[model samples]
Target: MNFVLKTILEEVRIRVFWILICFSFTWFTCYWFSEEFIFLLAKPFLTLPYLDSSFICTQLTEALSTYVTTSLISCFYFLFPFLSYQIWCFLMPSCYEEQRKKYNKLFYLSGFCFFLFFFVTFIWIVPNVWHFLYKLSTTSTNLLIIKLQPKIFDYIMLTVRILFISSICSQVPVLVICLLESKGVKTFIKNRRFFIVFSLFTAALFTPPDIWCQIVVCLPIYLIIELTIFYALIIQVYKRQLAL
Candidate 1:
């Protein structure tokens, strides 16, 4: 009982320590990234012809809360991978060494992919969406002048939400690959044309009704499909060699 308690305490300590480490790293990264985040967010507004946006000061604390919340969210964005890694490590003892290697690589690679997707969205996709939406929205605004003076908190929260959701969803290819390995799916080469059509349709469904938006999203989906087919081929080759 004592030994088990000691092990539990040790594990708890490790988890706490790693979490704090992740928090600190995240804190510094947020400041470093804040300017870039702000810049990307502001780009969509730049294309607006009307230079009118004013913050409604509800209370003294509102502005402060907005800044604090945004900063903390930024921190959490950088920390998520570290936190995920820490959790992986904590739970790793029961896993086989082979699984450890595979999962560790997958987790780290996933983090890298997450950052890449966010970076790309911040640089291009979101700005295009925002700009397109804003322009599209202002078509009939001659009477009421329906401009967006979006609250800082709401704006930042929305930005974070989209990026986080997109990032999570971008792991679909990885999930598909894993499923293929586990016999849940077979090689899809024969259905390449169908997959392409289906992916484009998905792009159209998910994005606003715009050619550019659909293409921007669909391109990645198609690329993922191509990658999946290639990997499935490789797996088949390895299996054939084993059978021989």
Candidate 2:
């Protein structure tokens, strides 16, 4: 038994080491092109009307830090598919045949949801939020003029934070399904209202303080929750039929 456990641990360590090595290589490659990555990230900000197409760096190290951050984020974005495959490989050894098939489908669905929401955030949410904030900056009284001069480090960090939040939000359906399968659908049904409220609260918390932005984030989450519930119900009915 001890030998078996040791072998499993050794395998896990080897896989993890390889994953880290790949991640480091990707990170350095991204750092080499960090400027281009930053430009891509700042596209929405740059497209705003009546704004300077440059970001401010208050401190000497700020620019380098921002570049590093950008490179790290780009590395993760580029490596997500590879990372997902690694995860599947890591888990496949322990799962039963039936469970392995289910997990295979789940991983694919999860990857799709992850990239879908990622692009949605990049294409829609980020632009709208930046535009909204820029408009707020345009509001000036007679004596005071507010210009939207975003800091280099701050902008990249916020953008990355929003992307990370959206990525986590994208996993809700998979998480809900896992919970339903493990704890039984009746438990989820009983707490459905709370979950809905929590989802709305989470959307409000993560998004900018604009109602439109909140709605944009909330709508996908709501749709996915409902769809997950429907999927769970179908699975439940199918199981019942099989039993009969």
Cα deviation of 95 in candidate 1 (Å)?
A: 3.9
Give a tens-digit lDDT track for model 1, residues 144-220: 67666566656666566557546754775666566565653344554468767877887776666879867876887
Clashing residue pairs, backbone N/CA/C < 3 A, model 1: none
How many clashes show up in model 2?
0
- Backbone N/Cα/C clashes per model: 0, 0
Candidate 2 per-residue C-alpha lDDT over 1-244 given as tens digits, one digit per residue, 9 for 90 to 100: 9999999889889988988999999999999999999998889899877547578889999989988889988998888888778878878988899999999888888988898998999999899878887888775687888777889788888888789878978999999988888888889888889777977897888877989878877877877888899888998899899999
Model 2 off-target regions past 4 Å? 140-143, 193-223, 234-244
- Choose the strongest candidate by TM-score: 2
Name the candidate that leads on lDDT: 2
After the best TM-score superposition of candidate 2, give how far the Cα of residue 232 lies from its true spot, in angstroms: 3.4
TM-score against truth, every candidate: 0.66, 0.84
